[model samples]
Target chain A: MTRYLLRRVWYMLITLFIIATFSFFLMKILPGSPLNAEDKLSEEQKEIILEKYGLNDPIPVQYAKYLGGLVKGDLGVSFKFDNTPVTAILFDRIGPSALLGFQALVVGSILGIFLGLMASIFRNSPIDFSSTIIAVIGTSIPSFVFAGLLQYVFAVKLGWFPVALWGEFEHTILPTIALAIHPMATAARFTRTEMVEVLHSNYIITARAKGVSESGIILKHGLRNALIPLITVLGPMAVGLMTGSMVIEQIFAIPGIGEQFVTSVMVNDYPTIMGTTLLFAFGFIVIILIIDLLYGLIDPRIRLAGGK
Target chain B: MSKLLEVKDLKVSFNTYNGEVHAVRGVTFDLNKGETLAIVGESGSGKSVTSNAIMRLLPEPHGFIKEGQILLEGVDLAKKTSKEMQKIRGKDISMVFQDPMSSLNPTMKIGNQIMEGLIKHQNMNKQEARKTALELLTLVGIPRPDVRINQYPHQFSGGMRQRVVVAIALACNPKILIADEPTTALDVTIQAQILELMKSIQQKTDSAIIFITHDLGVVANVADRVAVMYAGKIVEIGTVDDIFYNPKHPYTWGLIGSMPTLDSTDEELFAIPGSPPNMLTPPVGDAFAPRNQFALEIDTVMEPPMFKVSDTHYAATWLLHEDAPKIEPPAAVKHRMQGFAQTGTKGGGKR
Candidate 1:
């Protein structure tokens, strides 16, 4: 297992390196300047600024310098953020996004599995139909749209909570719900389809023949098998939620990495853009690795394969 | 032997999009302690439905027992609530399903799969159940029980997996073990081994078994008695000797004739002509009439009642009627009948 993890981590490093290199060059190729101080500063002043940040060097030289800095764990400084280290800025923004994303994931998976399980148990009934409708609405409509409606109904009309801000537990609920709907819906649909099939599988009949209580058969035998497919989707879903919360964060005024990522991209903050992109890529890869590891833990068949 | 299970006029049906599918229509049989009663038929002959109904494991809101009673030691099991049946299922009556590849839960450890019933119905603690599970694996002839117990179902071969399934069903030492085509999905050689295992296990446990299969070869090997079903009903039931020798029903004759004995030189194997009637619009009289070559005029108009051939034999056919012509079985069928003694002796000697 340790060997497997070490190999995966090695692959992760190689992947991050490729992504870092690609994004750096991609940013350099874009038709814009990071320091767009046209007409505002004298040529000497602009030259000084450019030279200070080493942007005046040849593209290959700059690329070599960036790689040198990356190897030393330095992501350079954000040009638009008054020389703040890209890493520090990202670290500051990640906490809120991480908390919100984690909350959304936990809430979504639990509620989704519960709803899906109920829908499957009482299949062809109103509950099943309603969950299907819920899944459709959750996936079809955007989170920002849901965010606006929630703000209108609960915050503006009802005066139940703050309209837009990130501070206490109360403020987290609205954004979390908005971000959670898609994952919750995805998990629900997958869980329902998989659980329905698992419940009808030959093993479940074997369980019933073994005198397992109805709930026991459904929970222990049916749900465990159903969860394998659900877990497969969870990796991409989680990363999507974390990175996809940019619009939601903007609407709610939540200071998260997603909003920073958007701003950094718009202003051509070279270090910030590359840093955030690398971070998202790193997160996605890590999540996928974790999900792969989780598969081994849940299923012994995979565990043996992973062991070798 | 004392009677263990009795089914009287049991009818099962499934609700589908098209209409109600009368899967099992008025099937009745009785099982004695320490005996294996084989229910034989082609696909969709209601054999499996009958077994599932006995276990009360039929798919709900669709397939269900529509009528009659399932008596276990004189208690009406057909009337038992699902909750009540749950208690009786693994403790008193357990089932071994076909398709070992799919029967065992793929995600579970073999030991835990066997131990589940021991823990649930027998109320054994984890340690005791574990020990019992190991013993069951060993009993079913699984080598290295200690190691194999921790392994998942996918690690085992199909025959080994079926042994694990048998272990799970035998965990509580159920009085009535319903094996639903248990060897149907196995290799021919593996099928023999599994049958041998089941018989050995049965001799040790003395559990009455309801063996459902379409293989006459398997029937001759394992069964004490045979019940042949057609469409959704049992058309003939008798001692293994009676059905293989003095078989009265044309369907039974077809079934026996269809099987190729060791010395049969025939190139084209016999097949019972015509397909079974669709249950959605089941015919008015005999469901097998269209398929039976010996079918009489009255067979198309009215169903034949179970006519007693001897104390231990009964067949549902108009040929057994007093006024009906005494027609002989087909030449191929009579050939199989003549060769039954050799196969029967071989099967008994092997056991």
Candidate 2:
């Protein structure tokens, strides 16, 4: 197990290196200049600005410098946000996005599992049909569209909640729902498929033959086996929720790293963009690692089969 | 002997997109107390279906007992609700299936699986059920019962898993234990061990066992009476001696002839000529007529009713009619039958 984990971590490091290198070059090649804006500096002033942010330096030298700063835990300073250090800005706003994303994940998984189970149990019934339709809608529509529709209904029309901005628990609702919609739908559909397959499995038939009640057979045997597939999606779903919250956060006017990320990208704030991208990538990599470990824990067969 | 279980006119069918597939058609049998009745058939012969129908464990939305009366000690199980059936299932009647590796839950500990029925039906507390489960593991001849109890199903070998299944089945001391191809998935050595364990356990519990399998070799050792099924119906049923030595049905003769005996000199074993009839639109007459070598003209035209060969023997075949020709069995089968009869007593095989 230790060897397996060490190997996985090594692979993660290599993956991170590749991601960092690709993003660095890709961002450099993007059309707009980080310093040059429609309403801003003249040519010489832009040259000075570019020099300050290492944009005037060769791409290799700048990448090395970026890597050096990254090693020192200093993500440099943002050019678009009055020269604020990227780390300081991100640290301040990360709490709301993390909280919103976390809530979304928990809510989505629980509700998705419930709906999926209901759909499987009452398969071919109206509940299953409607749940399937809802899942389809949730997955098909983009998060931004769902967020806009939710804002219109709950905030603009219903007047039940605030239009935007995070304050208390109530402020967390819309953003979380927006973030949760796709994952919840995905989890439900996956759970339904996995559960249906498990319910028809020979083991479940044996359990039923053993005189186990229908509910007992489903909960104890069916769900336990179904968890393997369900756990596989949790890693990507979590990362998606965290990074994908950008548009939803912007829509709700919430102060989250996702919103910071979108603005940084728009104005070509190099330091903030690099910092946020690295953070999102790091978060995703770590979550996937943890999920892989969890796979071994939940199903011993995976562990016994010797981790893939 | 008082009848412990009686299955009357049991019919099971599956509703598919094409139509209703009649899996088990008008099958009937009776089990007395402390008896071992083996239902023998090839694959897809409805042996398992008849057993599942009695337990009401057939998969829904596709399979259902179209017509049947499964009476346990004179109580009609068909009329019972699901809840009522649950009450009777583990406590009164239990079943062990083929492929113990798949039967036992991979995630659950063997002890927990055994104790589940004990606690649910026997009203035993956790501590008591745990103790009883350990005792059962030991009873099923599993070595190191104490250490083995905490281990999951995957930790045990195939044979050990079957023992665990047996332990769970016997947890509530059920009056009837239905073992559906229990040894089919195991190796030869493990098969012998499991069959021996079942026979020993049956002696201790005095329970009627409904053993379903395709192997006549297994029936020779474990069964008291044998029911030979073809298609969806029992074509022959009799005491082990009657079926083996004085076999009357053509299907029975084919089955016995097909079996590879240790002393046989033939290079190739005999096999029944054709595949089983399609259940989608089953034949109006005898289902096995197309496959029977000794088939008569009436065999294709009309379904034959079961004819009593003796007080303990019965077979369904047009050849068993009073005016039918006295046809002799194959030479090899006759020699084997003669050998078996000379060596064995009235009750030679153990349950």
Candidate 3:
């Protein structure tokens, strides 16, 4: 197991390196420069600014410099954020994004799983029908649309919370709901499909024949088996949630990594854009690793297979 | 022996999108303590449905006991609520299914699967259940109970898994163990071992077994009494010797004739022509009439009642009628019967 994990970590490093290289080169190919917005500055002044930041260095020299900084765990300074260190700015913006993401994920997963379980247990009933309807609507509609509707209903008309601006708990509510719906739907849909299949399996019949209580059968045998596939879908969904939703952050005026990413791209802030992309890639790879480990824990077949 | 279970005119049906499928139409039988009664039939013959109905494990919202009584120790199990059945299942009645590959839960350890019933029905504490589970593993001939108990179902081979399945079914020492083609998924050698294990276990516990299988060879090996199902009804039922030696119903004759015997020199084996009738619109009168080569004219118009051949034998066929003309069984079937009589040995009945 230790060897397997160490090998996976090694592969992860290669994957991250490939991603870092691609994103860096992809930014260089974009049409505009970081100084495009500085129209009021004279040509000579712009050159001085470029020289100071070493932007006049040839592509290979600049690339070499970037790699040097990366090896030392430095993400360089943001081009447009008052020259702030990219890491410090990222650390600052990450709090609200992580908080909102975590809240949405926890709430969404719990509600979605509950909905799915109910649908499967009471199959073909009104509850099942309604749960299906909820899943369809949840997945079909975009998060931003839900954000707009939530703001209109709760903030504009009902006055249940503030309209926008991030401050109190109430301010966090609408955006979280918006971001939560998609995952909730995805989880519900996946859980229902997997559970429905599992509940009808021969083992379930064996469980019933063993005179296991209905609840016991559903929770222990049914849910445990169903969870394997659910985790597959939920793992990627979780990474997407954890990184923050850009449109949602913008609409809610929440100072999050997603909004910072958008602003960085608009101003051609290379370091901040690279930092955010790398953060998302890192989260995705780690989540995939965690998912692999979780599979071994949940299913012994996989666990033993990996041993050899 | 005292009667352990009595299934009287038990009818089962499933509601499908096309229509209601009358899977089991008025089947009746009784099982005595310490005996294995094998219900033998081809696919869609309703033998499995009858066993599932007894345990109240039929698929819900569709498959159900349409009518009749499943009397377990004089108490009607057919009338028991789902909640009530929960207490009776795994404790009083347990079942081993056809496919051992899928019968045991993959996520669970062999020990926990065995312990589940003990912990639930017998109310055994964790430690006690664990001990009993180990004993069950040992009883089923699985080596190293200590290590095997902690292992999951996938670790075990097909035969080993079936043994684990048997261990789980036997955990609570159920009075009635319904083995629904338990050896169907096993190889011939492993099938014999599982049969032996079950027989030895029955001897120790005195649990009555309702063994359901389509294999006559298996029936002869394990069943004291055999009930031959055709469509949704039992067309012939008697001691194992009676079904094999003096099968009266044409369907039963067809079944025996189809099996390949060890010494048979025939160019081709006999196969019952045509498939079973669709349950969506079950044919009138005898369901097996179309397929029975020796089917009488009355068989198509009127269903034959179970005529008593002896105190322990009965058959549902017009051929047994006093007024009907005497017609002997086919030459091949007759030869097989005589072969068994002289040798005092059973045919392999290999498909």
Candidate 4:
């Protein structure tokens, strides 16, 4: 198992290298540069700025410098934010986004899975119908719309939560709900489909014939199998949530990496973009790794099949 | 022996989009304590449906007992609430199904699967359950029960997994056991071993078994009584010897003849002509009339009542009526019956 994990980690490193290389080249190839795009700077002033950030160096030399800096945990200075070190700016913003992402993930997953299971169990009933309707609306409508509706209803009309901004736990509630809605709905829909399929499986029928209680059958036999397929969606789904949260974070003025990442992108701030993009890619790879490990833990068949 | 289970005019139907498919139409049979009654039929003949109905384990909202009484020891199981059925299932009755790979939960340890019924129905605590689970694994001939108990179902081979499933069904020592084609998914040699294992287990526990199968070959020593089902009804039912040696219904004759016996030297194997009648709109008279070459005119017009053939044998066929012309069984069947009587491999049915 450790060997398997180590192998995945090796693969992740290679992936990050490829991503770092491409993003760097893509930034260079674009018609603008951080220094070149500054219209007010004179030719000599632009040259000085370019020299300071190694922009005057050849493309290969710059690429080599970038690679060396990456090895030492450096991501250059952010031109978009008063020439701040990209790493320092990202570190400062990581906590808020992580906090928001973590809460949204936990809340959305638990609630969505619970609701989906209910829909599956009480299938065709009123509760099942309503949860399905909620799930459909959740999947069909975009998160930004949900954010607006939530702000309009909960913030403007009810005055339940503060309209926008992040820091206070209360402030995080509305944005989290908006960010969480899509995942929660997606989770619900997937869980319902998978749970219904699992419930109809032979082993579930065996459990029922074994005289297992309704709750026991649904929980132990049915739910475990149902949850296996959910893992596949969750890894990419987490990545999507992180990237998707940039909009939510911006809308709510969450002061997270997402806010920094977007501002950097608009100004063509290559280093900050590279740093943030790498973080997301790393998170995506690690999340997928964890999910793969979880598959083996949940089902020995997966492990054994891989072993063979 | 006391009557362990009785089904009176039990009819099961599936409400499909087309219409109500009469799966089991007014099938009646009784299982005595310690006896093995094999319900033999082709697929969709309602053999499995009948067994599932008895346990109230039929697929919900559609598959259900349309009309019948599934009486367990004189207490009507059909009248019992689903909650009550829960108590009866695994405690008073248990089931071992087809497909060992599927019958046991894949994620669960073999020991835990066996112990699930024990913990729930027998009220065994965790420790007690674990111990019983180990013992059950051992009982079912699983090697290294201690180690085996910790392993998941996938670790075991198909035959070994089936042994675990049987152990699970036998966990609470239910009075009645329903084995729905338990050996159908197994290899031929493995099939014999499972059947043998079940028979020995039955001897030890004395649980009345309703063994459902399509293979008549498996019925010889395993079954005490055999019911031949066709178009959702039992066309003939008798002691194993009666069915094997003196089968009265043409359908039963066809079933036996279709099987390749040791003495079957003929190059071209006999097959029953035509497929089973569709149960959507069951035939007006005898459901098997279309397939039976010896089918009388009355068989097409009206369903034949169960005619007494002997003390223990009964057949639903107009040929058994006194007024009907005396038409003997096929030449191959009569010869085989005589050969079986002389060999005495199957107990002679008053030869």
User: Cα lDDT of all candidates, in order?
Assistant: 0.90, 0.87, 0.90, 0.87
For candidate 1, what is the DockQ?
Answer: 0.87
Candidate 2 docking classification: medium
* Fnat scores for every prediction: 0.86, 0.52, 0.89, 0.73
Worst 10 residues of 4 chain A by lDDT: A299-308
Give the lDDT of residue A222 in candidate 4: 83
Chain B TM-scores, listed for every candidate in order, come to: 0.97, 0.96, 0.97, 0.96
Identify the runs in model 1 with alpha carbons over 4 angstroms from their true place. Answer: A304-308, B343-351
Q: What TM-score does the predicted chain A of each candidate obtain versus native chain A? A: 0.97, 0.93, 0.96, 0.96
For model 1 the local lDDT of residue A247 reads 95
Best by lDDT: 1
- lDDT (Cα, tens digit) per residue for candidate 1, span B68-166: 999999999999988998899999999998999999898888888998999988889999999999899899999999999999999999999999999
After TM-score superposition, the amount by which residue B107's alpha carbon in candidate 2 deviates from its true location, in angstroms, is 1.6
lDDT of 3 by residue, B1-351 (tens): 899999999999999999999999999999999999999999999999999999998887699899999999999998889999999999999999999999889999888999999999888999999999999989999999999999999889999999999999999999999999999989989999999899999999999999999988888888899999988999999999999898898888888888787788743566789999999898988889898888889988998999999999999998899998899888878877787777664434432
What TM value does model 3 have? Answer: 0.98
Per-residue lDDT of model 3, residues A1-308, tens digit only:
77888888999989988999999899888789988988999999999998988889997898889888988989999888788999999999988888888889888988999999999988889999999999999999888889999999999999998888888887888888889998898888888888999998999999999989989999999988988888898889887885548889999888999988999989898889998999999889999999988988898777844565
Q: Candidate 2 has which clashing residue pairs, if any? A: none
- Cα-based lDDT at residue B222, candidate 1: 93
Could you list the CA RMSD of all candidates, in the order they appear? 1.5, 2.6, 1.6, 2.2
- The TM-score between candidate 1 and the true structure equals 0.98
Q: Model 3 chain A, poorest ten-residue lDDT window?
A: A299-308
Off by over 4 Å in 4: A304-308, B342-351
The fnat score for candidate 3 comes to 0.89
Candidate 3 i-RMS (Å)? 0.6
lDDT (Cα, tens digit) per residue for candidate 4, span B121-195:
888899999998888888889889889899989889999999998998999988999999998999988988898
In angstroms, give how far residue B39 of model 3 lies from its true place. 0.6
